[model samples]
Target: MRVIVVGAGEVGTNIAERLQDAHDVVMIDRDRERVESITYDQDVLALEGNGTSLETLEEAGLERADMVIASTDIDETNVVICGAAKAMDDAFTIARIKRTNLLRTWERSEEAFGVDFMVCTDLHAAEAIVDIAGLPGARDVDSFANGLVRMAEFDVKPTSPIAGETVAEADRYESLTFAAILRDDDVVIPEGETVIQPHDAVVVIGSEESVREFAGSLTPAPTLEQANEVVVVGGSEVGYQTARLFEAAGLEPRLLERDPDRARELAERLPQTLVLQSDATDIDFLVREHVDESDIVVAALESDEKNLLVSLLAKRIGVGRTIGVVEYGEYADLFETVGMDVAINPRLVTAEEITRFTREHRTEKLAMLEHDRAEVLEIEVDADSVLCKTRIREVMADLPEGVVIGAVTRDGELITPRGETVLEGGDHVVVFVDTEVLDEVAAAL
Candidate 1:
């Protein structure tokens, strides 16, 4: 598909960079430096111009585009850009919105902004934070088949029970499969003979119960002894939404904000949450306010440095778990190295979400694993495909080494595929694949 991305900002650049590997991506940005940078850095056509201009869209070959993604910083500009693209070409349009109010307005009337899909960076990031916080020992987690099947990544510790066990021996869970392991920067799709090492991040996919049990065997998140003891150290949109999600999940979270006005505002909006107007960096204040008693500490400050400091402070004070929201993608690894359990990058979350829509294949759901080393895609099998009438075990050799069919859903029923389980024409298959073999798996199925 010829996809046109109309921004060279963080989110747009990431989307274009990832999509360029599989699709013909054209990026348009008014900034000359960004346009030149992307042109030199990525395998995509970069154009410098106002994206909202009709002439710029024409120059970008909008007529030939299968999809148009407007991801500029300005929400109104993105909406206008999508609307313009919709008027000219018969292409699917996607708009990035930073504000929830604009999203709400668009949601009230479907296709209000001529966008087939809408992605909000803050919301995606907040939801990801919530997902990780809700699960014990999960640095990253994604669900498939209506939460029946889940894949979670756990940072292996020296004290972990299965640290030195072979994959075959460690994977004793009936419903679980060790999907992939991250040893330092390298991604390993573990074989049965592969040995699990300490400090390696292992990803596993299985039934919810089985995954939870496996997570518990590792360095799991500390359990919340009290009902409302989660501390959120920011009043930003992501922080506010994280608190909101916690409230929805029956957890009373305390939110701390440095700005008095913002803290008061959050207090009013989040009546259930105990909003504190104090600097979270102050160890004295944290101890005085009893923030140390909280089981989980979420750092969602605007600055990456501040978030890291908050996480470090929480850890120093013996907070059960510390999750840091790092804005820059590079800082995520640093956070992991510094003992921050989870680092949620909003840009990566938004990029993964948008990249899924840009895929030519009919992908129902998609997630990135191991710092984008691999992707888990849930694709509906077509009738004419080679896998339509074959039993999975028979085609084991033909399937790529990096690809593993995690789960199958037929007629809305989850089927745990075993050696003898047959694949039908229209089965919704959940596949975990190394990025190298993504195209091969897509072609096979």
Candidate 2:
């Protein structure tokens, strides 16, 4: 597939990197330095030109492109780029937007702005955060097989019951599969005897009920059902959306915004949420309001530094968990390393969603884990698929070391994968693949 990505920002660069291995990728940016940097560092062609210009699109070979993604920082600019691309060719167009109102407008008519698809950054990030909060001890969460199958990543602390247990011993859940173990810098395909170490990120896939049960076994943190006190800091779109989602889940959360007008607006908009006007950095205000009693505190401030500080303060005040909304991709890991429970970057989330959408023809669903070190993919088995009509154990022998069949679904029923299980055509199998062998596995499956 020929893919042309507009705006060489972090989101566009990430999409290009994910697709360059299997497709022809071309990136365009107005910044000369970014174009030059991408030209030298990446395998794809980087063009220095404006994406909204017809001549620049022609120079980037847009007429022959299979897909065009507009990911500029400005929403209007991105929409215009997609519109220009659609006017010139039949290539599928995708736009990255931040406003929910625009997303609603686009939903009424997907072709309204000449965009085939739209990814809302703030809304998706908030949904990701809410998904994490729904599962106890989960750093990341994604659903597959039409919400029948769920994949979750959990950080194994020294205090966890299964911290030192072997994979075989920890495989006690009825329908759960330990997909992979993420050590410090390695994606470890686990065997029966593989020991789970402290601080390792463990990825698991199974039915939603089974996954939730396993999560409870890993930590003593209260489940969302028992979680009574949830606090949201900042009145940013992400924060407002997060609180709104919590309300949808039948929980009334508290939101703190420093600006009086913003707080008033939030209070009027969110009848269930308690909106307070106060600086989150003020220690006295936090303590006086008994913020320490909250079960979860989410920092979604505009500035990454402010979010980091607020997360630290929440953790220091005995909050059970702290989720920080990181603006920059590089700061996400830093926030988690510095004691934040989870750090979500809206741009990265948007990029992953767009990349997955681009690959929908091959895979039913895709989730990138540990910053792209590994991936969990759901693919339907066809007559030509290697997995079709083959026992899983026999298939494993022919495949590489890092592949794990997490779960299989057929005719809307979940099937726990085992060595003796024989996969048939039309089965949607969710497998974990090391990014190193993703292309190979994806081709064979």
Clashing pairs in 1: 137-221
Give candidate 1's root-mean-square deviation (CA, Å).
1.7
**Stretches of candidate 2 exceeding 4 Å from the true structure:** none
* TM-score attained by model 1: 0.96
lDDT by residue (29-123, candidate 2, tens digit) is 99999999999989999999899999999999988999999999999988999899999999999999999898999999849899999999999
Please report how far candidate 2 places residue 394 from its true position, in Å.
3.0
Q: What is the C-alpha RMSD of each candidate to the true structure, in Å?
A: 1.7, 1.3
The per-residue C-alpha lDDT of model 1 at residue 427 equals 88
